[model samples]
Target: MPEHIDKLSISVVVPVYNGGKTIGRAIEHLLRQSLPPAEIIVVDDGSTDQTANILRSFGSRITALSKANGGPASARNEGVRVANGSLIAFTDSDCFPEEDWLKELVKGFHSLEIGGVGGTVRAASGGLIGEYVDLHGWMNPQCARDGSVLYLVTANACFRSDLLFQVNLFDERFRKAGGEDTELSVRLRSFGYEFVFVESAIVRHLHRRTIRDYLKNIANHGEGQFILETLWPQQRWKANRRKEIVRSAAGLGTMLRFYRSYRRQYDRKRAFVFSLLDHCQYMARIWGYLRGKRELSSSSLRNPLTRDPSAVVYPNENLGSSSVLVPKV
Candidate 1:
């Protein structure tokens, strides 16, 4: 620990599933951070590809763990199991970060009230779909005053290890990357945890390029919103009963404004086209939300203990001895 800086040991946890193409790059970036982690832990969620092989080659440089096929939430929980650091920094396998990323993250801990810190998750260059995502600021970690955030995105966020334990980790029920972080954030907010946004601790996120993938992401976000709404009703953020006509009209107005401001980035023609596409995607998201609502209702009826009155499972019932530590060096 330096005299001027507080001693905050950070462990970087990256949960990867079939990210063989990008995991290597993510790890390489972590290794180069100015404020490197005490250990870089990569939790492989039963990837059937060369992801496991790629992790194996890293050897002692990182602690690689493999678990049965679970979503990003469960994999991240496993990473916390073996983490031996005061702070737990999380990022996705597809992110390539700037060198000072961790250094900037650590500065947030100067205030003891700060529970977590988030960096901007910028979109990497892709095709039209990616441009739409970036334009919309989808999945990007947002700006916040030092201590005035609900929670930060897990893709480029760091939390106090004790705070995570107090919250009992993420809900394993989320079988995708979608709603788990938001759910966790809701809990942290209720507990009065202060989340900060570090503009400099940035990572470039790889957005989906293909239309199919982009649409799938939009739908997943909708589904996750449904699950989150049900799980944390106290948040009291209700969905609009009206979707198509009202939302599309509002979207059109927003697009027109967006185009005028960002014409250099996306011309009028392209902006108009993307806005229509965005509306269609939003419509598709409504469908997904409805399906999720139906599924959640049925699941709740079958397992009465599935949901708490507060929505999330507090004290994490599944914090059993089942989690394994696969420190494959």
Candidate 2:
């Protein structure tokens, strides 16, 4: 073993499905990090695409695990079980990390109590997706204090491995590929753990490639919130209400501000309208979450776990499959 083996630094966990087109590049980026991880594990969630073959090509450079079709949450749990590092870093297969990502992440753990840290995110392409991402440039060093942040993004986040085990990984019940990260983040905050924002560590997240794709992603966010609330009932009513209200208002304000600036820069009024429409889509989804919560609370018998009036049927088959394409980070 190398000298660093004694320290057993950070372990990076990447849960992949049909990511053949981008997974290799993601892994290559990690391997080149300034502070390379002690361990790198990729969990294949029953990928029917070239992902499985590409993983095998990596040889012993990365520990690859496979299982029947389970959601990313379950796949991540598997990676956590075999990781040897004290800290765990997570990034999606579609995102590319800056060369200093691992170094910046480790630097944030100056104190034992610092359980989590997140970095900045930018778009990979210069299209509509990139425009939307740029609109949120406040996420850059301009906004982050490098000390602490209200929220941390999973796409470029690192966590204390020990703390992760204590939280029991992400909720597998979040069958859809969304909001599981936020659900985990809010829970960690409730438990008194602090997350820092490492402004210098940047990730190029390849979000929705086109405008239509962006709207669809927003719609999924709605469904995810619904499922998350159903699983954690107490959290649904408490501080969650206040958080949602704040996020909603902030989102609307940000969209309007971005639209006016973008329209002036480019002569396209349509772009401004589309941006407004995206914000409206988000509001619609938040409404869906509210409705789903109300229905769940009013009709206890509707829960599939309960044998009562509604008698909801539980789908035995694993909800996540290789056919489903998750968002590009």
Candidate 3:
């Protein structure tokens, strides 16, 4: 540990929606961290289920907040607003962090230049879809060719609270649970702050079990990709219809390669199924990309002058009235 580590305080923020069944377990795991956080904040993003009741059951163990059905980005922004720690760690309600997760994440912030640190995600359950997701390292931090992290997945990531404030927190325009983290990372990188990846800081995530769920996740990612490209045109490459078609065509070869790789470990039947799902994933992503393009175009037409992709809005600036922290019962 660095000499300055003792001066840092950490807070764990969990943004959840309709996660009544798993939120308790996630909180439990957080509480058992080897390097316990100074505070644990869970933001309930207007869940229609028994999520509120479950949160209440946690009592004073966590600081629970309730708000309208804003996306994960908005919910996370709310959590960051009230966090009392210098380091804010984020994880999903469906994730279970290991005992040393926080310790390892904190260790990565040994210097002032590191704006954030992220860990790897492992699948909690073992099913066909789960295995596929784990095998492909689906939720791991996306890295550059030289091993620099491009973006940290929020499923297991920690960032400096001050840096987050400087970036104006998360972009609420992302009305879903994807791409907002990537955009934040890009903005953070712009400040010349590096991000470290701590392989030992592991979190077990409950992956999408069914094929329908998996395909939906892939499609949502496609939409997020479009949003990122629009928001940071200079940083992200814009894909045209020609590029999209070419990418889709090339996906066939990728699928075959994945199938061969899977066959080496699993049975032929399972490999075939995995390859088929990969094809479906490609189609779903393309559809989502096209849909996102149309939605963005419509949004631009509706508010041509007011729309500013570069602007970062903090939660207190606009969302203070709409979001409220529920007092501990």
Candidate 4:
């Protein structure tokens, strides 16, 4: 069992940029946690707005660090540097955890062999679209003793301090808010680390509120896949290609089976129409991934933040050119 929460067994990192609007609420929630973090480190990834002022308002209740506009990965890495806890936990500036978030996280440590763990993430939206997405299992916990390539989401994840270094930190190369977390998790799984899934350690995510936001999120997923391709090259391409074919086939087979069953009971025409739509969406995602590969090849692939004058282009936007903000303690 995780030894009783010591002086500070966990270091929660929250990377903030342009979070002026909602960051204060996030911090406020963290301060109210049932098992408050040993230290709540917020990396201000060079915000150009009231984000800095709001952060300052927190005073010494939190540790705030400022750096040039590095992407979320860079900011998170910075948080890792200054963290003095045995366990490194992460949440976005936009996400909030259950009061027992830390307590439940401690519970997952029941196994000494578990190197890292993730919790359930529920959507924090009351809208119809949000309800639909949540129903589709966006944050549903996959109870697995070990992680598969399929089960990865960084928004509600935590890692042992040492295991994190073993994976070499989040891939900073992904400058656009996607896929680095999965790539790292996949890599860890490859090394035989068990990625325990803790259902009790729940986190609620404030997902994109609009269709535009959802589309942007999916497109970023494509771009992130592109970056992963560069790192693993042959393996990435092969794995993705295999997944595309298998999932595409399975998706088709599933629809066909549903159609046959429905045809025996009701209208064949309706089943055909619904099945077609489902297949089309699957095909579209596959096509998007292929296009993303070619597009990624053309991307300058240079992180604009660490570079020169380009960083000033969006001084007002605190969103990491690469990091997606989740709630942080």
Clash number for every model? 1, 0, 0, 9
Judged by lDDT relative to the true structure, which candidate is superior, 2 or 4?
2
Q: Give TM per candidate.
A: 0.82, 0.75, 0.87, 0.73
| Worst ten in a row by lDDT for model 3 | 318-327
Residue pairs with backbone atoms closer than 3 Å in model 4 (clashes): 17-318, 18-318, 91-327, 92-326, 92-327, 93-326, 95-327, 175-322, 177-322
lDDT of 1 by residue, 19-107 (tens): 99999999999999998789999999999999999999999999999999889999999999799887899999999889999999888
User: What order do you get sorting by lDDT, best first?
Assistant: 3, 1, 2, 4
lDDT per residue (tens digit) for residues 1-329 in model 2 = 23322353789999998999999999999999998898889999999999998999999999999988787778888898898777788888888999999888777775544668888888877676566556666234222355446556667888777656555667665555666777777655655667877778888877777566665666566766776566546435468665765475457676776577667766566567556755666566666566555554534322312112332222212111112111111
Q: Who wins the lDDT comparison?
A: 3
Q: Residue 117 lDDT in model 1?
A: 86
Per-residue lDDT for 18-121 in model 4, tens only?
Answer: 88877888888778789878899999998988999998888999999999886888888899878877778888887888888877876665543455778878
The parts of candidate 4 lying over 4 Å away from their true place are: 2-8, 140-151, 233-292, 295-329
Models sorted by TM-score, best on top: 3, 1, 2, 4
Q: Where does model 3 exceed 4 Å of error? A: 235-257, 297-329
Give lDDT tens digits, candidate 3, residues 1-329. 66667777898999999999899999999999989899999999999999999999989989999999989999999999899887899999999999999999988987777879999899898778877777788788888999998889999999988778766788777778778899889877876778999999999999887889888888888888778777766545545754764565466776787789889989998898888787788788777778888877645423211133553433321111112112111
In order, candidate lDDTs are: 0.75, 0.69, 0.82, 0.66
Best by TM-score: 3
What is the clash count of model 4?
A: 9
> Residue 81 in model 2: shift from native, Å?
1.0
